[model samples]
Target: MPLTILTADRDLDDRAADAVPLPHAGADHWRRPYRPGPGRVGAAAVSLLLASFVLLSAVIIVAAGALPAAVICSGVAVLIIALALRFLRVGVWVSAHGLRQVELLRTTTLRWSEVAAVRTVQRPVRWLGLPRTVQGQALVVDRQGGSSLRTLVTDHNGDFLARPEAFERAADVLEAWAAEYRR
Candidate 1:
């Protein structure tokens, strides 16, 4: 479904600010809100291009009967694609039900009430974190410090990973949804 952002949540993380306002669900304008899937900077595309070069080179090596070299190059090409996809996992979602934290095989959704706060954490340098998938995105949600729920997020998904600032926009979406539903 298409996710058109109405307004964003401003105080989801601001301790000094008020709580996240909520709008009643099923309102005329109320529909699920999800963030734009991470932008594709063509990194994967570039990776593919490079992998093609490597595989082509492998073919040349094979022609010369350099079986070891060809196999090595072919293997390298496969590795490149795999690593790129790993570094760039896609499917980070946001909706009225809650925000979705995506991963390679499984996905998790954080409901509105369970949503404690959303904020951008500053690090000395950009970290391509994995497992939690906070690598490049700046939007870090403190899932109200759920007793057992671990935070959900994956590293980067192409270009959007580098622009975690988009998370602020993501936060706005959450805030706006809350306002519309004002429950």
Candidate 2:
């Protein structure tokens, strides 16, 4: 109490106290830390356009007094819309539960216990999930017990195509989550 010196640590503490708290992924819910790229948005737009055409044809069929055909067209339009929604949902998601990778036709989830490591590596990644490969970074997940490595997210994927900084931040966040939960 005789002499109290405001050291660097104390100064940092004061600055931190005044700093705005940033939002983080919730402990209980799922979060997608990256933004969807143009490829995904374009696909969704095409899907919606197809759905609209189908719906319009359904209306025309209904006007032509073909009730059954109109109903079938309506159903097909609904299915297309559902597929578009699913396409939009395709990406990497993280939560307390684990990491989830949603593809066009399937979803894979790996628990934190099952994950050995999540790291970013430079490699040839599919360009927007196409056959054309591009030299970029990918976030790969290694499972425990020598299982096959899974590529969770790639800089060329729909979530990060042409966005290197965003990909790096997403990879870092994923690595942090894996590190926190793997312990």
Candidate 3:
């Protein structure tokens, strides 16, 4: 017997043994993997253009015999690449237990019991401190907390608004699940 086959069999056996039985677990558990939509792709394209511009600037600076300035521009380009990679990894995961928002730097989970309300609200994109783009619908999650009224999901960066219809559909499914499984 090959070691690879032995290792695979052992892994399968381990997973089967570790799996716990649930009373109601099959199709009731909803799952969604957030993928990049047209809006998100466009956003990424703009970032790529900006990065190219930065690289061009660096080349120009180096041609002018300014090694330090070119290094600074290269550093800025690296920072932009890091930030873009982080943004691309942002995702939302929905299950029977809760809705989890996964980002590059942080993850937040809100249980069905914790959620008070899920509603759409108008959000405007701003430029130079003034509203510039058309107002879009933002999915807001109201949750109960101590002190004054608290909220959980704000959709601050317009992730939920990127595809309003799809987002609303997902939100509707989540709301239905919450209603059915509220504890």
Q: What is the TM-score of each candidate against the true structure?
A: 0.46, 0.82, 0.50
Clashing pairs in 2: none
lDDT of each: 0.55, 0.83, 0.60
Let me know the TM-score candidate 3 reaches against the reference structure.
Answer: 0.50
lDDT of 1 at 26: 37
lDDT of 1 at 160: 37
Stretches off by above 4 angstroms in model 1 are: 1-40, 94-114, 119-138, 146-168, 174-183
Task: Name the best candidate (by lDDT).
Answer: 2
lDDT of 1: 0.55
> Which number leads on TM-score?
2
- Model 3, 30-125: lDDT tens digits are 455333444455676788789889999999999999999999999998887777766665665667687666666887777767876666667653
lDDT winner, 1 or 3:
3
lDDT, residue 96, model 3: 67
Write model 2 residue lDDT over 88-138, tens digit each, in one string: 988889888899988889999888899998888898999877899988888
RMSD of 3: 11.2
Please state every model's RMSD to the true fold in angstroms: 10.7, 10.4, 11.2
Q: What is the lDDT of residue 123 in candidate 2?
A: 88
